[model samples]
Target: MAANFGELFLTILLIVCLTVSSQGREMMEKKYPYLRLASSFSSAKARGYDYIIVGGGTAGCPLAATLSEKYRVLVLERGGSPHGNLNVSYLQNFHISLADTSPKSPSQAFISTDGVINARARVLGGGTCINAGFYSRASPSFVMAKGWNLELVNESYPWVEKQIVQFPELAPWQVALKNGLLEAGVSPFNGYTFDHIYGTKIGGTIFDKNGFRHTAADLLAAGNPKNLRVLLHATVQKIIFNTRSPRPYAVGVLFKDENGRRHKAFLHAGRHSEIILSSGAIGSPQLLLLSGIGPKQDLQRLRVPLVVNNEFVGKGMSDNPMNTIFIPTKGHVEQSLIQSVGITKMGSFIEASNGFGQSSDSIHWHHGISSAEIGQLSTIPPKLRTLEAAQRYAKTKHEIPREAFQGGFILEKIDGPLSRGHLQLINTDIDTNPNITFNYFKHPRDLRRCVYGIRTIEKIINTNQFSNLAEDDSYTINMLLNMSVKANVNFIPKHTNDTVSLEQFCRDTVITIWHYHGGCHVGKVVDRDYRVLGASRLRVVDGSTFATSPGTNPQATVMMMGRYMGLKMLRERLGRRAGV
Candidate 1:
């Protein structure tokens, strides 16, 4: 397996190097002059920064760029730069990146307490570097519900779209998926749109026509290079607080570099200066808890110094549950990621992908077996599965030569799952994943939505558009769906029976679309302006603050929110300076 990866890595590297012209290489360097290694980050400049943004991710990158337009901004990313990483930069290597179990891999794999295997972005671009690259704006209702200035939200979307989003030319498999969706009565076809309309539509992708992925890290090119300083491989251990004042507030952050050298980055004394946490859903809350701002009992048990004691810090956690079925095709299907989507009013989103597999030399290590290769493990029966077994099973699912094996997946994912969970710290290590559970199907409504979504997928399979790709008429696509939804509850904790019902299948087969949001939510943890309720000069501006996952994919809105909120903050600062 190691030998296989080495050859694959070399080939991918050669491809990436050839694809990037000299002019392109020069442009990238010039575009991000301020980006540097954490070792080069000088502590002398700590107090000079106007804002210290943790996590140079989907929200953090744009936020730093926008703020750097006027202020001295610092972005500390725990991961390395995404500039030349073949796994992060190429569309075909998506699953390979996630399958990489190395400590420095761009995708950080983790299992939810609900027994679902998931991943978090460990690269500068965050999830944008590791995601399916689907791009679409949030629904108007989503904007309205968040009480955002709809005009500003509208303006912010274009700012992000212009930089990274692109209209994807549909692959043959994508066209088939679109036709099948429409044939299944999803709705009026909305072709080549970024709007989140309830219909079959072709959405934007971050991967350009050349199949090179453009991540949020690219947004840093928009920053004022002289004012913005990006520090890579800087893991922020905790937020330093100033308790001397009547109101406790953040003063700086204590972070460590790759070499384990600790450093402190302090904010300028400016009244509007702040420490923003764009460390993502799992990250933001975990940081807060580590910093002694979460439930008092948890903090006390952990023996951390309490700062504000906000119990809701890690509350309201939710993940969109997805159920998928494999569709093996006899003929060739071109490889593609998410492009076509069907947004049903029934609170589910339908999507598909095809023709992703590894070469014969590395078939044993191929990671494209699980659905769209999102690398899920919950699909395996819990009682018989370990992480290694699940991963090994996923990788070696295809025994035939790569060319001989061909298939795709049709997936249905429930939206805005009402089922919620919480996150708790296991230890103080900043790099350690906090214990989290989505409590999938805890609410009966979530199960019903899953059933509805799965049934819609059945309708799509039954359509002639999809039948064209199937191996034969005898193939039963809905075999799993036909199973019962009820049985005596005899399973052990987190384990289920082999002949599970559809409802049990929804629970048993549940996996993350990696769109999990809410560990710190709006109103409960942060205000309308995204300011932490009980803390000063601290705010979380990422998916962690979302009450509901936006649209089909939240990256667009996440990027938009970063820009929108940064503009708002800049205006506020300018207003205060002008004595407004």
Candidate 2:
């Protein structure tokens, strides 16, 4: 049977692409032809390598690919390979794997605790394998908006986008959604958003003909590098550390391959040798602690002698409190809308200049505007601006001021912000899953703020700007005013200045959108340069180092960070040799 509806293609591709996992017995035969894991560990194994990268994930895959250009690089992946897996090739088939019900092998496994949020891929490709194909670049305003230098991120954006092949337009069958928002008073912002951010008026999805998700896995496959060795279904249980001088240095990695036997893999970082930890956020810290580089208390608990007393190593934990508003429209809209459109084939019309439709691929970007621009829009009601901006935005393509977007418009985090969660060992046994608590909505402001944000969304949806056109005669534009919905709505906890409907949404409706971040944050675990402050010759390169949470999806930004760090490592190596 052919696709029943349009959105199915996008929905399917978005689910499966480049997921990486441990190369276990379950899938020893189902890997890509070019890459394979080591069968058995040899004590006297060949150890002369320019660099050894740990954790083949969002950061690992890219780092391995980039460093291989000049150095002999070895990527240690704990998961099995899903390379050339057909369930992944055809977009429709990808959704099944999203189930993650494939019984995990001792050597190969992936942890999916939430229905929507997939933790990390225990496969050769990492999260790219299972994440919905929502590839978005870092917001420019998000970059230049503050913190890191603007020019550096600006330069890196082009570099990473080119490597990842960030799509430029919506796939065929996807509605412009831009038109639906004319009533909402929003506009197309040069950044990334869901298929559509504005109500009634939304945006389109980006995709290709075959509809395969294009993640780092695809990028590496395309590069076809010669010397890159990707070890799949291989688990790195510990990092061999040396503490003769009272400071431990990571000199090697202890891993278990498909057969469940242990092997010692050494890191030779002298003169031309080094080890870069590009492991996904969770894996990075665990490996570090296994190697004895995490918090002192954690290391002691595991009976693993600590080489460093970095309390912040695994403490800064933070994941974006990302939640979605599923407005069930009258028809089978999700499927019908997607199957009807493609990126380049669709019309360019949109509502807000800062909303959607202007750029086919990304929904928003950093417009690099001024404080004056922000002040100008400050007084304008968010709902009216959303409606007018979205309508005017659909007419043509133009850049909107990114600064005006400084504080995001997606405000549903009503209660105090959730406190950061921690990752602790549930069992010292490396194979056992660790204890991870996100401590969601722990802060009082989290519920309140989220409630407030939703109100804003409701206001936009209910306003005359939206109701005038969206409401029906049976339902006065006033009837559609959401008064009934609002009346029945409970934004906070009841019986005590709070409510229930919103509470359920807070506790269950939201989770990290595969964007878990800042576990070993800057100023706490590792320095801004991503080096473990107290430990020498050890560093983290994944999302663990994210200083603060990025309000949007973090793949492009994190991958670029890997690239940037790779270059910095090389340049610094050059400097150390030059005797500067």
Candidate 3:
């Protein structure tokens, strides 16, 4: 039986090469056959949408494909449709869509009350369909200090790098993490570019070259599919407004759809009709304090109904606190994510990932430790530790075998974290999770930029381009970065060690590189033409109008600020109907 017919002809040639690589990602989602005329929420309501966008994710699908190329947009999306999600179309199942704790997961897990767990990006190409897709851009002094128009942010980052960016072929552990970040001085190598340039470059990836991903809902195939609609689970939940004069306005939104039914949508009589939110950065300030628009004593202690008190709608929240290291390799590396970064002019960026596997029912372990036993319990001696003695020495160690969970991690984060926090709510349930608190490193210059980015990842694993990841070539991962370089810093605050400072090991290993942005910032809650200050036709474009967390991954400047604020609100509505 000739080796059982050569193992059934190599499992039918690996299922015909994964069905011809999933029909080349379904021929790029069949070049948007109008994204299957996206409906649902029980086939939507009597249409009236000259722009109603809200969280279709990653700057609301390029701001509803540049306001559907001239108004009539709608998009709503509350997860569903990363079209045939093989964990969002396989870049080797990227951490199975962020360890999918499914309740219709598209990566939504939350935690932060500064205890930090963090997730949020319920699909619809939001967080670029559960990120790791590392595209870069932003940092021409963060587009001339956010007053933008650096030639329309360089022509809106090549119209989103010609639709969901790519350029990544690197993998050989990202060429030894880009020769261990230019042998750790993090210099010169500007090799590839999406330009946020500082040093060790490579950046750009929405994951293609066969590992397919390309989201921001594939830039909605550059819109105008008869003025786009896109509905999917559709959650919105508030922001109706029109509060009878003294400046209130906004006139639409109150969603629900995935059969919890309730609708509403408005804003069509064009006086440059609006209602955008691009729901991110904790869903545009938790839908502006659940539509009462914040702080009148947290909308009268949650008995809601105020419209505009504006105590900076959920104040300045921030996140970018990451701190990894992990590495492991006794051999075979290859698999990747975040093609080598390392920007660091002391504000810290440094990135990496190579070989990410997971799935032993998403192998989570806090008290059971193992991520190389919490990177060998951060090499002990910080006054005889305590995370209950590193969980009893990672519970007498010894696990690591889900096929040796191969290597990767190295991260570092820290940029622009003037350590802020606030986002309260606790209820108003448009799918709960509010009380955020990114108070990490509560500013000591963000713990000296996370101990100078963990001493630049301990000089990028003592360079010599990480001397073939130590199988006795002795870079013993710098003895697990001795006092700091955490093991994915899985939330350490519990009677944390008082000193032996790497600033108390960056306040006992903070974590969250989900690159959190402010609550609704830009001159405190939308101004500079992103509207919303005291309200009108309300606006708040993504990353809650970021006050910092731009380059090195803020999804290509949040999909080029949703196509440069939808081509600057279609040139401020054709320059106010040609009156300009």
In order of listing, the candidates' clash counts read 0, 113, 1
Per-model C-alpha lDDT, please? 0.82, 0.50, 0.73
Candidate 1 lDDT over residue span 234-343, tens digit each: 99999999998888899899999988999999998877889999999999999999998988999999899999878899999999988766565667688888899999
Q: Tell me which of candidates 2 and 3 scores higher on TM-score.
A: 2
Q: Which stretches of candidate 1 lie over 4 Å from their true place?
A: 1-31, 45-47, 357-374, 382-385, 391-405, 473-500, 575-580
Using lDDT, give the best candidate's number: 1
- Poorest 10 consecutive residues by lDDT, candidate 2: 367-376
lDDT of 2 by residue, 245-324 (tens): 66656677778887887877766667446567777777777777777777777788879877777776666566545433
Supply candidate 2's per-residue lDDT for 325.
33
Q: Of the pair 1 and 2, which is ahead by TM-score? A: 1
User: Model 2, residue 67: displacement in angstroms?
Assistant: 1.1
RMSD of candidates 1 onward, in order: 6.7, 13.9, 21.6
CA lDDT for candidate 3 = 0.73
Least well predicted 10-residue stretch by lDDT in candidate 3 = 367-376
lDDT (10s digit) by residue, model 3, range 1-580: 9999999999999999999967754674466554432333332555667778887888788878887877688888888778777767777666666645667888777666655555787878888877778788878888888888788778888888886687888887778878887877789899888888888888888888888888888788788888887877778889898888898888888887766768677877666688888888888888888889878987798788998888888788887787665555577576777877878788888787656443445443321111333222333432344436545645654342432345566768888888788889888887988878777887788888777777677677767767567445453434443312333222222222333457776665555658888888888778877788888887988887787888888888888888888887787778646421
Q: Arrange candidates, best TM-score first.
A: 1, 2, 3
Off by over 4 Å in 2: 1-34, 40-45, 103-118, 140-152, 168-182, 188-207, 221-226, 269-272, 334-418, 456-505, 575-580
